[model samples]
Target: MVITVVYGVLAVICLGYFAGIVIYTQTVGFALFWLLTGLLLCAAGAYCAYRRKHPDRLEMPLMLKSAVFTCVSVGFLILAAAGITIFMDTEEEAPEDLDYLIVLGSKTVGREPSDTLKLRLDAALEYLQENKKTRVILSGGKGSGEDWTEAQVMYLYLKNAGVQTHRMVMETQSTDTEENVIYSLNLVKKTDTVGIVTNDFHLCRAQALARKQGKTEVYGIPAKSNWFLLPNQTVRECFALLIEKFMGNI
Candidate 1:
């Protein structure tokens, strides 16, 4: 009875969360994951209830049940551990003095920076305004529906924010975070103290990749993430961190 109640409640909460994201962000791919898992849990709960009400209908081996339970338990534990690691890096302060700032790219609508990109740009602008000596490396490639490369968009945005052209460098060939680190780091010398500018939820993986790419002294200048998208993105970041680890990308 307790198990049924827990599963049923989780399923409802999951579905409600999914609806919340879709309604708020109009985004789909990232939001589908938790919703699907919740529905699966709902099915599982239904099966458990059926087994209880109609014991003779189907008999499950105790070992199979134990295995399923163990897998779910272990999965939650792993996610919790990853969440902890991610949260520890979320509010990292950008060092007062820095040689280089890496403003990582995000989606752009036509030539305009997307909301996420805007937050990064704003954060980078604030940092640059305060740290006059810091040079910036704008990283990202052109994606569909984008009128210009991500680097180009960031370059213009920063330029408009009063960042001098000479203080900024553009690395336009990279399309992903690993490439962002690889290509951007090349533009800056090894001795430079690098700081990555991105949303707070993304700092952990971004720093990890920077470290993996041999920039061990790199730091994160985390920008504010949109509150409406925060829950889904935070959860997504856990899976992303795990994958990056498995692939040795970070």
Candidate 2:
């Protein structure tokens, strides 16, 4: 009965997390939801293994094994669900008509943009080239170390890539994803309809965050990433989605 109640509580938490992800559509919320779910499953599995090993405590070895398998199976299923979501979310489709292109930030080592950030910038640049009339907003702030802010680095990169300075705006005060949209919104005029650009695994959350910040017409432009790193990134996103849901940030 104790084990059953514990499992029930864990199941409830997992269900809440799942609902939060689908409803809030926040990456951090999904992340946190899965994080908690994973931890619970792992804990349950360990407890069952312990009970199985202690034959004097529990008379039914078969029951303990079944419980362990169930816990592990549920955990694996949750991870698989998150993986499938990431894969399905990866494709980038250009919006029909966009007034603004919002390029999200990534890490910088000194003055150079990280590979992830570069991919996002490349995708955004491609979008700009295809739609020459849209204004670009390079959004991100500086972290510890290094030279220029993410926004400045992106601006310089875009400038060097032949985009005109007049066509670009910069929002350099945002330190995180939530702040990225919040701060960027200040730079947007009332007439602008924004499309956010980020990596494929990142788009769902970014779009959700943008919508939360009142950018109703936001679209996602996702950049590509290698397959091996995809799993870790998806897992990270799931945790992030959960946190955002809890905080009501998205």
Q: Write the per-residue lDDT of candidate 2 for residues 1-250, one digit (tens) a residue.
A: 4664566577666656655554542235334545576567656656666665774784557888799789879877876765566557456566755888888898786777877788999988888888988989999998766489999999999999999999999998999888888888788876688888888888877888888877777778888764534554677777677667778887
Give candidate 1 regions above 4 Å deviation.
Answer: none
Output the lDDT of residue 195, model 2.
86
Expressed as tens digits, the lDDT of each residue in 1-250 for candidate 1 is 7888899999998899899877765567689987998999899899889988998987888899899889989999998898889879567676887999999998887788988899999999999999999999999999766789999989888888899999999999998888888899998889989999999888899988888878889888999989877778888999999999998787
List pairs with backbone clashes in candidate 1: none
lDDT value for model 2: 0.77
In order, candidate lDDTs are: 0.88, 0.77
Pick by lDDT: which candidate is best?
1
Given candidate 1, what's the lDDT at residue 3?
89
- TM-score of every prediction relative to native: 0.90, 0.70
Q: Please provide the root mean square deviation of candidate 2 (C-alpha atoms, Å).
A: 9.2
